[model samples]
Target: MIAERTEQADLLAGLRPDQWDAPTLCEGWRVREVVAHLTMPFRASLGRTMLDLAKARGDFNRMADTTARHDALQLSAADLLACMRQNIDHRWKPPGGGTHGALAHQVIHGLDVTVGLGLDRRVPPERVALVLTGMKPRNIKFFGTELDGLQLQATDVNWTHGTGTPVRGSAQDLLLFVCGRRLPPGRLSGTESP
Candidate 1:
């Protein structure tokens, strides 16, 4: 998680000021909102999270989305990056989720910005594999991946999962695809290759 956070910080550091307002794969969230979301755990205390949850009427997703939107308006790009860099080693985890979940959070959100921006940030193969292996049906559902009749095969790694129409690509690309982001076409090939 620390390594992933560091990689994200480095990427953000090189972003042009205009890029901060760029839209991300996360609907309604710009790059700055995504960064704010990434650093949210570091800034939001347990009590505050609970309060936000109440305000969201017990919807975790709503609480998260609303907080990210609110925080983005208050935080500068540089401050967001600094918070992420400083919290690289922070052990904060989601309710009932441990270290692996923390890694998934960082990796997926990192891809949210990089992949959405068309940047070449390849998450290390090992880290990608780690998250892939840990992915469960519930996780897939949470991310809204449409895998009911689709198989995902990674060309750059010895990993394959799911069934039906094959979706083949690099592990990182496959990860992004499974997380419900459509690549700009040609990055993933289906089994029948339409």
Candidate 2:
């Protein structure tokens, strides 16, 4: 987790100022909002998080979106970067989600910033494999992607999941797919590429 966070910090450090406003695979979020969302766990207390959750009427997605947007407006790009740097060793996992969840959070969100910016960053294969291994049905349901009849095959790594028509890509791209993210054209190839 620390390694992932540190690597992301390094990646963010090299971004051009305008890149911070670039749209990500996260739909409505830009680079700033994604970084703010990534660093949120480090700064928000459990009670505060619960309050925000309540404010969003128990919708985790809404709360997350609200907080990310709010924090993005409140903090500068440099401040978000510093928050990530300072919490590289912090062990805050999503509720009911253990260490793997934390790692997935970092890897996916990191990709949100990198891939969204059209940067050619490859997540370490082992890390991608680990995350793939940890994927659960609930995670997919939460993302709301319909993968019932589609197979996910990673061309760059020895990982494959699901069944039916194959959707092929590098493991990281597959990860993004499973998380309900659509990649730019050519990132994925298959009958059911999204």
Structural similarity to truth (TM-score) of each candidate: 0.95, 0.97
lDDT of 2 by residue, 1-194 (tens): 98899999999999999999889999899999999999999889899999999999999999999999999999999999999999999989888989999999999999988999889889999999999989898887888888888888999889999889888889999999888887888888785445
Per-residue error (Å), model 1, residue 50: 0.4
List the global CA lDDT of all models: 0.86, 0.91
Tell me how far the alpha carbon of residue 86 in candidate 1 is from the true structure, in angstroms, after superposition: 1.3
Q: In terms of TM-score, which candidate is strongest? A: 2
lDDT (Cα, 0-100) at 157 in candidate 1: 80
lDDT per residue (tens digit) for residues 54-147 in model 1: 9999999899999999999999998998998888889888776688889988898888898889898789988999999898888888877667
Clashes of each: 0, 0
